[model samples]
Target: MEHSDEWTFADCFHAQKELYRAIISAAVSIRWMIEHDFEVPTDADLRQMEAEVNRELCDAWVEIYVLALREWLDGQ
Candidate 1:
């Protein structure tokens, strides 16, 4: 996956460092959600619980992609 800001990393080392952080944060958030039983809020409550859930999911995905991309870059 392509990072939102390519300028953030000048070399593979930087990418790996950044990705490690992303992975840790994602794992924590996902674990919290799972432990709390994140619920899919209804349309009536889209602005509340549902929106938060969506954000969490998006964050998780970004972290995973970043880590995978970092690994790929490392091999290059």
Candidate 2:
């Protein structure tokens, strides 16, 4: 989504949720790295990983936007 300085309450909550999800994801990755030697993946591997991650994040953002829009429309 495009950046904005103004954030409503629900937007803030969604932002926080996204941040928390990212942190938790990072923590798991870090734990895995600590347990084993991390090796760089091939270009194809990177692309696949990126695609999966992007899809998941997009789904999350869609959910957030849908909820926010629903609430906004309800108020009208």
Candidate 3:
């Protein structure tokens, strides 16, 4: 399959969807931690959570891109 750097509308839309999902999931996880933990999260803990969410967002974007590429190839 030929690879193109261009992105389609559907690709952007799906990426946005995945990003929103990741954000929501991160928010829920943070809330859970805040509610269940005996002490407030330390600065290091917050930093770790931030890093994890960033990784999750990056993974989601990559997954969306791969899926879009596969669909484009199938349509070819």
Candidate 4:
């Protein structure tokens, strides 16, 4: 468990370290959900109210990966 002020950044030598891992973790979870058929059921009916939220989640995962990679490379 981590106990630090959310607004604070940790010390950096080569890098702050935690940023990349947290971003990767979230991306991994989203990928797993998609690969495991987490979005099998769909709310496609207008009467039932509908949207492909899983699609959006996957997009968010890609965005996270991009941010993580950019930060890591910049630190190097």
Q: Which candidate number has the best TM-score?
A: 3
How does model 4 score by TM-score?
0.33
Per-residue lDDT of model 4, residues 1-76, tens digit only: 8886433222332232345445545665566557767754344332222123344445565555555566555665
Question: What digit string (tens of lDDT, one per residue) describes model 3 on residues 22-66?
Answer: 775778577758786846778887777777776766657766676
Provide TM-scores for the models: 0.34, 0.39, 0.43, 0.33
Q: Model 2 residue 13 lDDT?
A: 53
Q: In terms of lDDT, which candidate is strongest?
A: 3
How many collisions per candidate? Answer: 0, 0, 0, 0
* 3 versus 4: better TM-score goes to: 3
> lDDT per model, in order?
0.57, 0.62, 0.69, 0.47
Candidate 3: C-alpha lDDT: 0.69
Residue pairs of candidate 3 with colliding backbone atoms? none
Q: In candidate 2, what are the lDDT values of residues 35-57, reduced to their tens digit?
A: 55776656775565556556656
Give the range of the ten consecutive residues with the poorest summed lDDT in model 4. Answer: 44-53
Error of 2 at 52 (Å): 15
RMSD to the true structure for each prediction, in A, is 9.4, 6.5, 6.6, 12.0
Candidate 3 accuracy as TM-score: 0.43
Candidate 2 vs candidate 4: the lDDT winner is: 2
Runs in model 3 lying further than 4 Å from the true structure:
1-28, 31-38, 63-76
